[model samples]
Target: MKQVNALTVAAAVAGALSLAAVTAATPAMAKSVKCYGIAKAGQNDCGNKAGTHSCSGQSKVDYDGGDWKGVASAAACAEMGGQTKPFKGMNPKKKSS
Candidate 1:
């Protein structure tokens, strides 16, 4: 019983340390990324830009540009083509995604 208790405590401490290390090593969530647009206008507006036209929401990662909309998650925005200049008012279905 004593050995088991000691082992359990050691394991718990090790696990906690591991978790802390992971948290420390993990990079801060990037503010933005260079993503692609899957639609002209849906939850996001990647079509505002020229050339891109329609994208799969799968573009490159960008750390800068525009403000973030809480409505769109980083992952979701990433799928659309990074971030864009913060939008105002509700987003309407202009071109369809």
Candidate 2:
């Protein structure tokens, strides 16, 4: 039986680590609850998910209910004058194709 070379094992490990790093850098799909009408301008937890922009810091307006912010607690959402239920923004429009 041929024993694995130490250098080959190290190279494989290093390659795996770098791949994990790249995957980790991308945002994970968190179990975040939707908090509506709470996002400050350019401070949303994620985009409208309507292809507006990438997640986080994408909202262009403040308190845009259409643009929900992710939160861990419903209490915190209410404290921030946000609704647990989602709503339409000031200007409702069709999502782009």
Q: State which candidate has the highest TM-score.
A: 2
Tens-place lDDT digits, model 2, residues 6-92: 778888999999999978855543656778777777877777745577778888877776677777678877776777776766423
Model 2 — which ten-residue stretch has the worst lDDT?
Answer: 88-97
TM-score of each: 0.29, 0.53
Off by over 4 Å in 2: 1-29, 49-51, 90-97
The lDDT per prediction is: 0.42, 0.70
- Model 1 alpha-carbon miss at residue 7, Å: 0.2
Tell me, by lDDT, which candidate is best. 2
Error of 1 at 68 (Å): 26
For residues 44-79, write the lDDT of model 1, one tens digit per residue: 323334333344232232321322223245577655
lDDT value for candidate 2? 0.70
Give lDDT for model 1: 0.42
What is the number of backbone collisions in each predicted candidate, taken in the order shown?
A: 10, 0
